[model samples]
Target: MQTTISLEIQRYRPEQESEPVYQSYEVPLRKDWVILDALNYIKDNLDGSLSYRWSCRMGVCGSCGMMANGTPVLTCATFLETYAPGPIRVEPLINFPVIRDLIIDMSEFITKLKQMKPWIVREEEQPLSDGEYLQTPDQLTEYKQYSMCINCMLCYAACPIVGLEPGFLGPAAIALAQRYNFDNRDQGKKQRTEILKEDNGIYECTFVGECSIVCPKSVDPAGAIQRYKVAAAAEWWKSLLLPWGNR
Candidate 1:
């Protein structure tokens, strides 16, 4: 069996370099080690200047997301043995500006997420004495899958639309908007629809389905966008047919 592996990690220091470059480091190959483990080895032993993001090595925190051999993945969850006996290429998530090595800027994603209003909005707040807004098992199930998103930004990297149309609201944001839209206790669906129906919103998604395929959490963002399109079309037809009725 091979005793070691090589990782070609992308490096970028704006003050030092005008463009990103790859720097390679060799580390021990162990069956128990994941991609993050190799990265940690590089950071600690090989080169302390090597930079990346990671937390909760258990895969709960989405910070360890990176391009592993050209695929977007959570490094903590991807085992090194899967790409054994050779070099692995690691790069920052695409479709966003790289702040530094292995760390992409998330400001755009954050702005779009805020537009989704990823919380339960109410037309009228119920009194505290009225008790918490309750939901049944079925109601909880409606948005459970989307709620699993850890904001890893893997979906954004997998989405071609995000690369082409920089203004397009990426997959995770739309899926989260649907999460709140489906919640029984939320009254923010109407508000979210206004944003989603816009040019750079849900309509921009061409339904390539790669976003869902790469999602580590199984949050089917592509399906969510399609569902929203269907609903939006239906609403449009209804409004056209019944001019006098309240939408």
Candidate 2:
């Protein structure tokens, strides 16, 4: 069995250099070690200056997402053995500004997520006596798939539209918008639809489908955008045909 593997990690220190560079480090090839483990090894034993973002070592936090061999993946979940016996290239997620060595600036993603209003939105809050909004199993299932997104942003890295059009709302955000739109308790679909109907919204996506492919949670953001498009078109036609009907 191979005793070690080489990792070509991208390094960027704004104070020292203007361009990003690859720095290679040899790490023990243990069966139980994931990419995050190798990175920790490098930071702890080899170089303390190496920087990255990670939390909850478990994959749930979604903070350890990065490009592993040019593919977006959760470093904590991708085992080093998968790319064994050779050099594996690791970089910060693309389509975002790198804040440091491996941490990309995620302010844009956060702003887009806020635009989607991921929480259940209601026009009027029911009185406390009315109790919490009740939802059946079927109602929950409507948006359950999209709710799985942990904001890993791997989908954005894999999306060509996002790379081509910075103004595009991106995959995860649109999917999350659908999550709220489909929620039985949410009444803000009209407002969200207006936002999504903009040029930078779902229409910008050519549906390359890589977003869904790279999603760690099977969020299927491409599908969500398509579904939204269909629904929006239907609503537009209905409004046009029946001016007397409530919008």
Which one is best on TM-score? Answer: 1
Task: Name the top lDDT candidate.
Answer: 2
**Candidate 2 to native Cα RMSD, angstroms:** 1.0
Q: How well is each residue in 99-123 modelled by candidate 2, as lDDT tens digits?
A: 8899999999999889888888888
The 10-residue segment with the lowest total lDDT in model 1:
238-247
Q: Which stretches of model 1 miss by more than 4 angstroms?
A: none
Per-candidate Cα lDDT values, in order, are: 0.93, 0.94
Candidate 2: which stretches are off by over 4 Å? none
What TM-score do all the candidates reach, one by one?
A: 0.98, 0.98
| Model 1 lDDT tens row, 169-222 | 889999999999999999999999988988999899989999999999999999
After the best TM-score superposition of candidate 2, give how far the Cα of residue 135 lies from its true spot, in angstroms. Answer: 0.9
